[model samples]
Target: MRARFEKQLLTLHQELIEMGSLCEEIILKTFKAIEKEQLPNTKTIATLSEEIEQMEQDIESRCLKILLRQQPVAKDLRTVSSALKMVYDLKRIGTQAYEVSEIVAQGHIVKSKELHVLQSMVDSVREMVTMSIDAFVHEDEALALKVIAKDEEVDENFDTIKVLLVECFASKSLDIEHAIDLLMVSKYIERIGDHAVNIAKWVLYAITGQLDIDGGE
Candidate 1:
């Protein structure tokens, strides 16, 4: 029974990693659409989003089954529960990525300084998503802490983008509709960073059995 339980746990980790990869891919597609000033195929983004949602449901069912059949204890229980919570954040990240792509498809084009800051935000956010899942897969608390710390950089980038957009508005360089779309995209990116932080915290919980919202600091 114990050996089977362990195998199930490994399967859970593999599924989580797969779902995280899908999240990363969808976000990158959105970033490319925005950066290159090209309209992404909305159907492709929608299909990715649907796949993410299906993964979330499948993982949730697996976790529940493990809990019912294996009746995990202590750290084992924590690991399974953390994954159940983690999938929700993963789903949210995928949903927001799709939303960002939709906004870009609607002719929202960023340029110059704002684009540079936005690029930094995308890079940081993608790293956080990847590292958070890595931390969970390896049970590495330190890496999870790093992902939580990185959220600050994403937050700062959002602030810088907001300031630059406001300045453009003041100088009559950007119209209100375009400014709103850019702001919406940045806000979604900020929320994705927050979701990554949540996943990292869950990683710490699965390892230490304590959920530290402040990155264990």
Candidate 2:
């Protein structure tokens, strides 16, 4: 029985990793599409989104099964619960990537200092998502903490981008339609960083079995 339960836990972990990989692919492709000002293959992105949704359902079902059948003890319970929470974060990241792709497909590009800043911010966010998941899978508290600290950087950059976008629209340097699309792309990347932070928090819970009192301080 113990061996079987361990196998189940390993399966859950593998599924989560697979889901993370899919999300990473979407982010990378979306970034490329945006940088090149070319629309990504919508068919491929849509298929990946569907796959991510299915993975989330599978992970949730397996977690429920583990809870019902094995009745995991304290540490094991935290592991399963953390897996459940992490999947939700992963799904949110996938959604954000899809939003980015949609904005790129709209064929809007703004040439400004703020555009460069926003691009850098998006790059950092993509790295955060990858590192956060790595921390979770490896149970590395140091990496998890790094991901948490990085969230502040994302927020700062987001604020700068938001202000610039507002100025662009207000000053007539950018049409409202283009400004709105760029704003949505920037916001999606920012939200992806937020989801990365959430995943890092779940990693902390999985490792220490205690929720961070200050919400991942």
Best by lDDT: 1
lDDT of 1 by residue, 94-114 (tens): 999998889888885646778
Model 2 lDDT tens row, 1-217: 9999989988887888889899989888887876675778767887888888889999999999999999998878888998888888888888778767877777766466777877788778878888987887788999999998998888898899889877876785467777787777888888888888888888898889778533421
List the candidates' TM-scores in order: 0.96, 0.91
**lDDT for each of the candidates?**
0.91, 0.82
Candidate 2, run of 10 with poorest lDDT: 208-217
Clashing pairs in 2: none
Q: Output the number of the TM-score-best candidate.
A: 1
Off by over 4 Å in 2: 212-217
Q: Once model 2 is optimally superposed onto the true structure by TM-score, how far is the C-alpha of residue 149 displaced, in angstroms?
A: 0.6
